[model samples]
Target: MFTNEQVDRFHKDGFLVVPHFLSQATSQRLLKISHEYLEQIDLSNHPLTRFTTSDKDHLGDEYFLNSSDNISFFFEPDAFADVDGHHKLVKPKERAINKFGHGLHLCDANFAAVTSGNADVSEIAKGLGFQRPRALQSMVLCKQPEIGGAVPPHQDSVFLYTDPLSAIGFWIPLEDATRENGCLSFAPGSHHDHPVTKRFVRRFDKETGEQLDGTEFISLENREQIEKGFAKEENQKWVSVECKAGDLVLIHGSVLHKSEVNSSNKSRFAYAFHLIEDTAVYDKLNWLQSSVKSILY
Candidate 1:
C-alpha cells in the first residue's frame, strides 16, 4: 500500500518514481536469467521478430517458433516475486541501420503477452486510488542503438486502447537509463485533460523489416513541435523520467510521455507493465450511460 502523499503525487503528476523496488541480489539474478533465456532461445545477438509488409513478407519462415513455448524466466530466483498473465509482455530491441538505410539492423520482439504480474499491479493501482481492480495490460519495451533508431514521442493509451480510466503502467529500466541513452520524457498531468489524436503511422527497419509503428514512438522534431503547440500551462509542467537500473516509474493511462533517441554506443532496455482495473466488479459503472448517470444524478 502507498501512503496518502505518494498516491496524491500519482494523481497530480501522472507519474511517480518508486526507488529500489527490486533488491540488488534479485536484479543481478534476473539479469543473468535474461541472458540464459536469450541463449536457450538462440537469441544470442537478440534477433527478435520484426514486422514485414504483409503475408508475402512474413518475417519468420525459416525461424520456427519454439514448440516449447510459455517458458518462464521467473523460475525460482526470478526477479518478479509475483505472477499472472494476459495483456502483453514483450522484450523489444533496436540495433542500427545498414548501408541501405532501409536495412534497419536490429529491431526485434521476444516473449510477449503475459498474464502474470496482476497481483503486483493491482496493489499498486489501489494505492493510487482505484476502487475496483481488473487485469488490464502489461508489456516490455527496448530500444538500444547508436543512430537512426530514435523512437518518436507518443502515448500508450493511443495504441493499446482499453477500458476504464484506471489503466496505469510500471516502467523499469533493465539497464541504467539516461538522457544520452534515451530515457523517457513526459508532459506532466496531461492525462487529467488532453486532446486525443489519431494513432500515428509506424516505420520499419531495413534489415529486419520489423515494423516500428507503436503508440510508443514518434519523430523527435515532430514531438518538439507538438509539445510547443500545447498551452503554456502544459509546456511548463513537462517532466522527463531518467532512472538508473532498479528504479521504476508508475504512469497513468492517459499520460503524455515518450523517450529520447539512443545516441550512445551501448544499449538501452526497459520494461513496462500496466493494469486497468483488477478483478473488482464494477457492475454499476460497467456502462457509460449507467455509470456516469448513476454517479451524476
Candidate 2:
C-alpha cells in the first residue's frame, strides 16, 4: 500500500517508485516461469510479429489483435538478422522475444496470484481513488541484451483510452534496472501538461464493418496542431528511473515516458500491467479488447 506522501508524489510528478514492492524471491519466481513459457514456444511458424512503438511499424496482425485473451509472443524489432534477403532470428527464441503479453494475469495462475485480488495492489488502487479498478493487461518485457529496441515517448492513454482517461501502469523489474539496460525515463509532471490528444485505434472497413489489418493513431485534436505539440515535446527533459529487482513504479496514464535501447551485456526483464477505472467508458475502437472476464479488485 502507498503512504500519503507517496500518493502525493505520484499525483504531483506523474510517477512514483516504491522500493521492494515484491520480495526478491517472488520476482525471480515470475522470471523463471516466464522463461519456461518462452522455452515452450515453437517459433517455426510464428508470424514474426515485431512489436514497435512507432506508428509506422505498429503490429496489427491477427496474432497481436487476438492476443487480448491469450498469451502471445512478440519479438524485438532488432532481434532479426538479414540473411539472403530473409529475416532470421539472431538469437535463440527465448532470448529474442521482446515480450509475451496482453492476458497473462487473466490466464496464468502464477501471474494472476500477483496481479488480481491481491491485497496490496487493491489497497494501492483504492488509495489512488479508483472505485472499480480493472486489471486489463499484463506482460513480461524481456529487454534482451544488445537487441532490445528503444521505446518512443508516448502516453499510455493513447493505447488504453477511456472516456475519462483513467489508466495506470504498474511496472516491476525482475532484474536490476539501470541506464545501461533501458530503464524507464519520465518527463516529470508531463501528464498535467500533455493531454490525451491522440488515440491508437483499430481501423475498420466502413462497408464490411470488419476490423482492418493494422492500427493508426487518430488525432483527438486538430491533426496539424497535435503534430506541432508532439514536435515541441521532443525537447522536454526526462529523468531516468533506476531501481533494483522487485521495485514497483506507478506511471500516470498520460505521462510522457520512454526507454532507450539496451546496449548492455546483461538483460533487463520486467513484469508490467495496466489498470483502468471500469466506471469510465473504454473506447470500443481501442486496439485491445478484453475477451476474458473482468478482473476487478
Candidate 3:
C-alpha cells in the first residue's frame, strides 16, 4: 500500500518507481526461471513473429492469436540479419528474441504470487484508488545485449483498451536497468492531457464466427488531430527511470513512455504485467480480449 504522499506523486508524475518490491532471493529465482524458459522454448516450427515499426507493415494472424495465452517470442528490429532492406531479415530464433510473454503469471506459480500473494500488487492497486483491478497480461522483456529494441513513445491504453481507459502496468526489473540498458523514460504528466488517440482492435466479419487474419485500429479521436495536440505538448520533459533488481515501476495507462535500444555488452532483463478495471467495459473490439474468468486474478 502506498502512502498519501506516494499516491500524490503518482498522480502528478504519471508514474512511480518503488524500490525493493521483491526480495533479492525472489528476484534471483525469477531471473533463473526466465532463462530456463528461454532455453526450453522450441523453435522447431516456431512462427517467427518479429515486431517492428520500421516497415509499417501489418502484423500477421500468427502474431495476434499466439500473443494471447502463449509465451511466444518477438524479435527486436535491430536483431535482423540485414538492417538495410525493407524486408529486414531476422537472426536465428535463439538469438533474436527481444521479449517472450503474455502468460507468465497464469502458467507460473512464482509469478502468480508476485501479483496476488506476498508481493501483493493487488493491494497496491487498491491503495492507489482502483475500484476493481484485474490482472490482464504478463511478459518478460529481454533488453538483450547490443540488439535490444527501441520502443516508441506510446500509451498503454492504446493496446489494452477499456471504455474509460483504465489500465496500469507494474514493471519490475530482474537486473539493473539504466538509461544505457534501455530503462523506461516517461513524460511527467502526459496521461492527464493525452488520454488516448487510437486503439488496436479485432475486426470480425459479422456473418461468420471465424476470426480474421488481420488486426485493425479504432480511432478514439482523429489520429492526425490528436497527434498534433501531442506534438504541441512534446516540449514536456521526460525523466529516465533507472532501477535495480526488485524495484517496481507503476505506470499510468495514458502516460507517454518509451525505452531506448540496449547498446551495452550485458543483458537487461525485466518482468512486466498490467491490470485493468474489471468492472469497466473492455470493448468487444479489443484485439487482446479474454474471458473475465480467465484474466481476473
Candidate 4:
C-alpha cells in the first residue's frame, strides 16, 4: 500500500517507487516462468529479429506483425547470429529474448497471478487516485547484458493511450536495476506540461472490413517531439530510478521517461504491465487490442 505522503508525492512528481512490493519467492516464480517460455522457443523457426526497429518491416512478418489474441515472444535486436553466409539466432535462448508480452496477463496463468489480483499493484493504483482501473498490457522487458537497446524518452500514452490520459505503468524489477545496467529515469512532473503527442494506431476501411493497411502515427497538437522536447533546464531535472528486485515503480501516463542501454555484463530484467481507468475512452485504433474481452482487460 501507500501512505498519504507517498500519494502526495506521486501527484507532484508523476511517479512513485514502492520498495519490496513483491517477495523474493514470487519474483523468482515469475522469472522461472519467463525462462520456461524462452526455453521452449524453437530458434530454427523463431522469427529472429535483432531488434524490432522496423515499423514497416513488421507488417511482413506474421508473428511480429499480426496482433494475436494470445501471448507472443519478441526477440531482441541481437538475438540473431551470422551462420556461414547469413545471420540467425545464436545458441542459448537466455541470450536472445528482448521481451515477451502484450497478452501474458490474460492468458498465461503464471503471469496473471502477479498482474491481476495483485494486492500491491491494486493498492498503488488506488493510492494514485485511480477509479475503475483495468489491466491493459503485461510484459517482461529483458535488458540483456551487452546489446540491450536504449529506450528514448517517451510517455505511456504515446503507446497505450486513452482519450483522457488515464493510464499508469507498474514496472517491477525482477533483478537488481542499477545505473550501470540501465534503470528507468524520469523528468519529475513532466506530465503536467506534456500531452499525448503521437499514437501508434490502426484504421479500418468501411467497404472491405479489412484492417487498415499499415500502422499509422497520428499526431496531436504538442509543442515538441519526444526526442528533442526537453530544454537544458528540463533535462537537468531527469533522475535515475534504481531498484532492487521486488520493487515496483508506478508511472503516470504522460510522464517523460526513458532508460539507457545495458552496456554492463550483468543483465537487467523487469516485469511490467499497464493499467488504465475504465471510465476513460481507450482509442479503438491502438495497435494492441484484446480479443476475449474488450482490449481493456
Highest lDDT against the true fold, candidate = 2
Candidate 3: residue 209 lDDT (0-100): 57
Instruction: Please state the error at residue 194 of candidate 3 in Å.
Output: 2.0
Q: Model 2: clashing residue pairs?
A: none
The regions of model 3 sitting more than 4 angstroms off are 53-55, 58-60, 82-94, 205-211, 221-233, 292-297
Residue 228 lDDT (model 2): 53
Tens-digit per-residue lDDT, 2-121, candidate 2:
789999999999999989999989999998999898999987788989888777768888899889878999998787889899888878898889999989998898888778857888
User: What is candidate 2's CA lDDT for residue 265?
Assistant: 91
State which candidate, 2 or 4, has the greater lDDT. 2
Least well predicted 10-residue stretch by lDDT in candidate 4: 53-62
lDDT by residue (252-279, candidate 4, tens digit) is: 8888898998999888889999998878
TM-score of candidate 2 versus the correct structure, residues matched by position: 0.94
lDDT of 1: 0.46
TM-score ranking, best first = 2, 3, 4, 1
TM-score of candidate 3 to 2 decimals: 0.88
lDDT of all predictions, in order shown?
0.46, 0.88, 0.78, 0.76
lDDT of 1 by residue, 233-259 (tens): 335455667787767788777777776
Model 1 misplaced regions, further than 4 Å: 41-120, 131-137, 195-237, 278-297
Local lDDT at 120 for model 4: 63
What candidate 4 gets wrong by more than 4 Å, as runs, is 49-62, 65-68, 81-83, 203-210, 221-236, 294-297
